[model samples]
Target: MNGENAYLATLMELFGRANFETRRPRTPEAFRLDPIRRLLEGWGNPHRRYAVVHIAGTKGKGSTAAMAEAILRAAGYRTGLYTSPHLHTMRERIRIGGELISPSTVVELFGRLRPAIEADPDLTVFDILTAMGFLAFAEAGVEIAVVEVGLGGRLDSTNVVSPAVCLITALSMDHTEILGPTLAHIAFEKAGILKPGVPAVTAPQTEEAMAVLRQVATERGVPLWTLEGWRYGPEEVAPSGQRGKIQAPDGASWSIRLPLLGRHQWENAALAVAAAIRLREQGWIIPDEAVREGLERVRWPGRFEILREEPPLVLDGAHNDASAARLAETAAEVFPGRRWGVIFGVSADKDPMAILAPLRPLVERIWLTRSRHPRAADPQRLAEAAQALGLPGRIRSEVAYALEEALAEDIPVLVTGSLFVVAEAREAWAAWGRMPMPEVDPIPVRVGGR
Candidate 1:
């Protein structure tokens, strides 16, 4: 029996227990599924007690999973949502019906898991979290669990389930070190969630990526649905938010006003609608009203999130090249003809230039910074790369200070390059009691020639 403070410390210790999430240690060993499977089996297989909606991808995985879970909750079902790489708190990684898992849940689970965890000392923090998610969903009596893959899907700890419907969002080249270097190789790793006789859906993918997905789905005897048949209308962009329409091949249409503003939000929303329609067909009993409410209620912070309006600050966790390019496009759309000052920080494992190239033309100037995360690249190193790439930027060392430096320029500010950067900035904004982006507003038309 522990108090809330002790429970918080225990969670921190559990996170620090694994070198996988925080410290960018060299490839210590191959990712194994057996430990998590065995742990769950020992716990009476709690994961098997509930239906699963598994999602995996290089980008948009978290957003898509959040959307799915929200839809489930809005439809009046008890739902469990699990996402990785917590922005602020470890409890954010586990949610039941749109709320963070209670500290009591953590304390109780710790009590039950101590023996199994102590017995198998090799289980990673991710493994323990996966086990906890299963147990939480089971204990909460959730009807469905929306589980986001922590990394590549095949060997990812969350892949143990044969989901009712599996989803693979837009795939790109992130986590190439563990997954693979090329798009096809990465696609193979993401496609690992496809199971026999289960329906799977994917966003529009590249020829190379699509070929691999089709091949894998075929080999797995899965019925694959492609987003090619889906059409998402362009967002009527606004400072407050965006409104868009999504039409599935089955003629399920939804006009949604999304609060999570960005380039790819509509596409992500469309994917969610498609998955929901499939879930309805599978007898989930979700109605159109629930879908609309779910889309409106869904909040995925740090993905092109508007934090304030005085200087028009945006916090997006666009860490990879594809996401960075989309961020640039969305910024151009939102703030037409307006130059932006960007505060950028990225992980060491990422290619800073790939992220910077697409973003360069959109940025007036850059403030390079390092996040508190150990995987953050050195600010000096990022500044050197930026100058060599002809993108002018200065180093600020700390993420919050860099944000301040960027905000001082009196232009719209963008904090991107990593979620870790946005997470750090968000903590500061919370401390200052800055208001959040308005839920919904119309897009103001901008004329050229400032």
Candidate 2:
């Protein structure tokens, strides 16, 4: 095999023995940081060598992280971005200067990390993957690394970094099985990233959430700010992108053409702009022009993405109630008075009825489907749930067939529910249209409890 295939084969071998990311939560003992702490210490703590912008939230954290990385890169800083559950390839989860890590580099680093991983008992897929990113960033000599929390903040593998600034964006119901069901409980968990005397920022949140965040920041002696004081110009929404003026709390605003659509993105852009300004105050030298340029260049795949034209077919990974509500609202605003067909599937753990209820009024038809994920809800189960909720939908066991049926409706098209479904839908779309999805090396193995 060539270098790329060799690396992929090695990864497959390593992955066969570990747990998949989508499994149900383990006990808190399974989440202890000491293992990663020891592992990183053995590797010389690569995370400590660079500045970090750590982000955690129920929504928009990924977008905020991407925007911050782009802005810093536009300001001439060598930046690294680390996010989780990549859509197409694992390399997409880690990037330096917006470029995915090369295959040779991945193999080379694994040569070094493999010994430590084998010697340690507690290392899992996400733990080792996150460590690989930090080491890669340090090796590439990145000046700033923007890290997104893989799951809940407190015990997530990526929480080991002592960041220069921390951010939380648009908190709501998500990962409730692990993060707790109450809004305040979830806020407290995310706020665990706030270090003593470290500056932090939050997007506008509910009174319940803000109270918890404020109390935690005050107790930790951290400086906390909110985007509520920030403002943005009226957004001109389009199938391609949205144009709006992002205004910081300092009264500085930039007219930007954010390549992502939706009003939620506008709120996310404001958070990113606020973070850029805060970083500037810390002597980062980020100019206003870089902010505009970065916002235009930032690309976060699988979140409110428009894939095809002529009737505005879109893909969004809105898997929860709050996010589904936002997707429904955005669909109405963008394709007003028009019906659309939805290709929907979700995780087995999520409340399918809560997710599908809002989309009922907006969609003309729903082709309920299940992705290839081991934990995806069954299509028949989803159809039953939809019927119970009085939401109309039909079961299509195969994603390709579901897409074919939905597109045959001849209205605007949307593929949503879970990010996993979105990922599969994108791959199916690529095959159906002779397009290209990024090359991924997935191991053929038993998934859970293996």
Candidate 3:
């Protein structure tokens, strides 16, 4: 194989050998920066060499981080973006300036770091990947690195950075087992990223979550800026899911346009813009035009993404209640008085009722299918769960079969409930359309585990 293919194969060989989720998962020992710190120490602490923006939240974190990266990139900064649980390729998790690190790069990094990784077999896959991102960004000489918290912020591998400005996106309850059972507990986990005197930009959150965040910020003496305080409401909501004349933190406002659908995204864009502006205040020097250009140019796939135009195949990875509610609300606003078919699947750990309860009213028919991932809830079980909610749906074992059935009706199909499900559907769609879904080895874990 060539360099790229060789690198890809090497990554597959490395991660494919270990169980990603269950291997050394849920070790919440108090925020030890040692794993990354040690790896960085071995690699000469590359993460410290670059300025960073650390983002942590229950929801909208990825989108907000992507927006921040886009804004920084638009402003002519050599940027590195690291997000988690990629929808398509593993390379999607680590990128420098919109280009994914080559497979050869991954192979080379793994080879270089193998001695360290092998010495400590206790480290999770995420920790090693986090190291790779830092090393890659450092080697590439990126000016700024936008890091998204992989799991709960307290013990997540990505929390090692002392960001220039920390951003907490809209908070909600999802990772109850690892983060916490209550919103406050979860908020505390998200707030773990706050450092002494670092300014934080956040979107409007629940009174409970906000209270905890405020308490944390107060104790740390870190300034907290709320997106709600940033003014300007929607001047017009177009049928095409576009908004006009959004107000900024400054007295001057601009007509904001986002390619992504949903009003929640408008809030997310506002948060990104607010965070970018705050970064500028901290000596980044990003222009207003760059902010506008970034917002317009931002592309977060699998979040209210419209894949096919003719029949309107919409894909959203709203795996939990808050995201599902947002998806339902956005659908109602974007396609008012219209019903769409839904191809749904979610992880076994997720509260299926919480997700489907709000969505059932809007969907014409539900095609339940299990994602190819091991953690995916069985389609039959999901269908039963929906039925318990009085929203009956058909079950299919395979994703492609369900997609075909949903598409046969010629109505708009909304594929959602889990990011893994969305990714699988996208892969199937790509295969069906004769497009290449970059070849990666199947994670060694069984479909439903051993």
Candidate 4:
């Protein structure tokens, strides 16, 4: 093997030791901030060195975090963005100034934390990566960092940050086994990120979720902002992007264009705008122009990403019922009545039927498959679920085979269910073209991001 491949494999081996993303824990106690806190403390508390905007929710948190970081970067701040479950490389989880973290830096950071990481039996891969992100950001002199919660906020490794602003995207039923079975229970976990006196922002939510959030914020004495006074004007959706106007609570409004598709993104953009406004209120120098420019330039791949035309090939990481519904809505709106063949796979923990149910009407056929992720659901199980839903398709053992079969329909094709499936299909398409498609960086790449 080449030196680069060997180095990448070494990194993978290091991360594989305690990766909960691949092997989920059965209990809630498996997630906590104490081990991460101790590691950060020993590293001189690097996460506290920079200002932070902590985000949490069932959906849209990654996009919201991306939007907020892009805005901050446009304002000329040395910004760090830390997100979870990347589409391609592990480096995509940590970025400085919109650039993926270098493999050498990851190695160096891991080396420094290895002693502490080895000593703690409770430490997961996320805990180590979170510490590395903090250290990397501090070492790079980052002025601000946008941190997305990896899982439920209360006990998540990323929840240790005392953020300047807290943002919650749309909430729904997800990670139910660990977080809880109800929306209120999930909201309580999400609301755990709220710090005393920190301003919090949220998208429109059901009464159940909103009540829990309000109660937690009230108890913590944190000011909360909702979309009650915010308004999104009519949006023009196109294959390239979408444009709409947002009216703030203060009677101020502005037109904004997002390169991201779906009406759901409009809601995420509104939350991001509110976050920027909250930051400005905290004496940040972000101007309105920065907000506009930042959001327009933000690029989050594998979410409604169109990989090809002719017979359009779209990729989306819609793992939950709510996000799956949004994906179906966007597909109908953007490509309307186009014959669609969906390639679907998901994590073993997810309810595949709930995800596939939304697309049943639009999809002419379904290609059931599994990504290479250890946690990916069995193709046989997925095929059974699809059959029960009255969606017809055969099972492909691998995502690439599913993509091949789906594309042969000469119709619009969607690869969805999990980010891992999307990543595999994307790479498969790129391989067929005799070209490389790396999500963030080209130097070092691997399969699983989560």
In model 4, which regions exceed 4 Å deviation? 1-6, 434-436, 439-450
lDDT for each candidate structure: 0.82, 0.83, 0.80, 0.87
lDDT of 3: 0.80
Indicate whether candidate 1 or candidate 3 has the larger lDDT: 1
lDDT, residue 179, candidate 3: 71
Tell me the TM-score of model 4: 0.96
Clashes of each: 0, 0, 1, 0
**Tens digits of lDDT, candidate 2, 1-450:** 888688878678556545547565645436767878888999899999999999999888888899989988998999999987777667788899999998778788877888898898678787888898999999999999999998778988899999989999999977776778799989988998999998999999999999999999999999999987778854687777888887765687799998877788888888888888778778889998899999999998788787776576788988888999989888887778877788888888788889888888876778889877778889888888778877668888877788877777677889999887777777788877646765655642213210
TM-score per prediction, in order, is 0.94, 0.96, 0.93, 0.96
Give me the runs in candidate 1 sitting further than 4 Å from their true place.
24-29, 435-450
Cα lDDT of model 4 by residue, 360-406, tens digit? 89878888888877788898898888999887688889889988877
Best by lDDT: 4
Q: For residues 354-392, could you state the per-residue lDDT of candidate 3 as single tens digits?
A: 999889788788888987777887888888888898778
Candidate 2 Cα errors over 4 Å, as ranges: 442-450
User: Once model 3 is optimally superposed onto the true structure by TM-score, how far is the C-alpha of residue 450 displaced, in angstroms?
Assistant: 21
- What CA root-mean-square deviation does each model show from the true structure? 6.3, 2.2, 2.7, 2.1
Q: Report the candidate with higher TM-score, 1 versus 2.
A: 2
